[model samples]
Target: MKQAKTPFQFMAASTLTRICGVQATNISELLEQLRRVSTDSVFNHTFQSLSAYHFLTEGFSNDFAQWALAACNAPQMAEQLAALDIRQYESVEDLRADLVQTLESFVAAEPQRAQQKAFEPFYFCEAVTVTVPTDWRAHNLREFCEALWHVSVHSIHYHFVSARLRGPQTNDFSAWMEHSLGLPELADRVEHIDIYTNTLERVRQLILDECIPWVES
Candidate 1:
């Protein structure tokens, strides 16, 4: 088995949620707040939402989509928001721009929807993440798979979904696999896991499944 050129240190993370003191009761308010809110806030609502509600079996994948449907009674707008493919965005600013544009288009088409009151106000929030090193470090593919099985789902989210905004690589695991282990095909498979469709636990399992054959080979 090929050993990694550099050992991959496993990491675990936890998020501290904070209210940014911005609230939106309707689409118009949401659009205005979204334009001015910090990138962290935009990230929290979209990317972080995957981990925050990882166990969700149904409903929209993002907070904005859920709020648009449940609170604002705008299913069409909700669908549009939910349809955003977060993987396409390399930065939070791009994600925020797309979010704003989606709402802008919706509001323009149905101006009455802008004034519609939500059942509960949408409070903009941001996540303060604290990532710490774990004792589980992998020098090879087999060790990596074993350590991955033992890490918390939060760790999976941190390395997989959240890492997209932090660097040029697709994710921590894929990058290490391709660059450190010289396994581009396996890395690409790991990177292609559809985060939007699967729960975090499911994501962890899928990653493990992908690594199994490579480990045995």
Candidate 2:
């Protein structure tokens, strides 16, 4: 019988240690037998944690691409991501850089920016009129991206909060958004708190790992 491969480690010494050029039968042996390897053995716990954050940020960016493609039929961005092999991004900063580049390319190819139109088209029964863009532009890419990210994060937060607060009865985005952001709120709703915590944690990780490194560079 053959031995099974180990489950992928979220944190694995083997991950960094396993080199392609090494001549060894097993990962463990490869690490042990290798000589004269250039290893930077800095015990910067903060830096490692920051790397994890960058990984998560890239993960989130991938997720966002999927969502955008599904919701808006904008498969170009997603296709570009896959073509770029962004999943193999060496570091968090690399992932962030690629994501920004992908967005920029997409925007640059667009002939025009989506002018703010009446929010009436998107407004459902519970949705209030909020002017929204139908498409994205590359020129003012950063500002557009900021708005896109803000809406998505808050949208999820509101959705979760509504599910907990309004029971199973509420079925639409409008109702959920209103109730979630509405007046007197209670402590029992786990969705709002949980989602916010998770999202912020992800954001903080991205900033430390991806943003800081890029800024320093």
Candidate 3:
């Protein structure tokens, strides 16, 4: 295996979730808060919630959609919110705008639904992420696969899911593979792993399933 020009450094992150002092009891209030809340709050509820709710085989993958169904008694709105593909968004602002628009459109069509109060208020929150470099560094494909097996699920989420919001590339692993190792085909495969549907551990397994064969070849 050829050594990478720039070695891939494995990193892990721990999230500290804090209440943002914003709460919404209905669709209208939720839309208001969505517009004003920080990008971290939007990212926390949508992208970060995926890891927390990864075992979900049905329904929505995000907190807003889940809340809309369970709390607000709005199944159609829930479907609309859940239908948002997070991958299409490059920034949390765009995601937030879409979220706001989804709710606005839904309310406009069914005006009565906006005032329907939830069983419990949806409290806005933000993630305070602290990332640290791990000891594992991979200079080649084989070492990269080895590191993948041992790194924590947090590392997988940090490098794969959360990385989308941080850079131009889809994820850290694909960027390194394509740019540093010159394996664009493999990089494309790794970049397509669905984070919304699988657990972090499952995501790790999927990445390994893609890379291990290449390493062995």
Superposed model 2: Cα runs more than 4 Å off: 1-61, 111-217
Model-by-model lDDT, in order? 0.90, 0.31, 0.88
Candidate 1 residue-wise lDDT, 41-66, digit = tens: 89889888888898874899889999
**How many backbone clashes does every candidate have?**
0, 1, 0
Q: After superposition, how far is residue 180 of candidate 2 from its true place, in Å?
A: 53
Candidate 2 accuracy as lDDT: 0.31
Residue 35 CA displacement from its true place in model 1, Å: 0.6
Supply the TM-score for candidate 1.
0.97
CA-only RMSD, every prediction: 1.1, 24.3, 1.3
Deviation (Å) of 94 in candidate 3: 0.7
- Sorted by TM-score (best first), the order is 1, 3, 2
Q: What is the TM-score of each candidate against the true structure?
A: 0.97, 0.26, 0.95
1 or 2, which is superior by TM-score?
1
Q: Candidate 1's C-alpha lDDT?
A: 0.90
Residue 106 alpha-carbon offset, candidate 2, angstroms = 1.3
Give lDDT for model 3. 0.88
Regions of candidate 3 where Cα sits further than 4 Å from its true position:
none
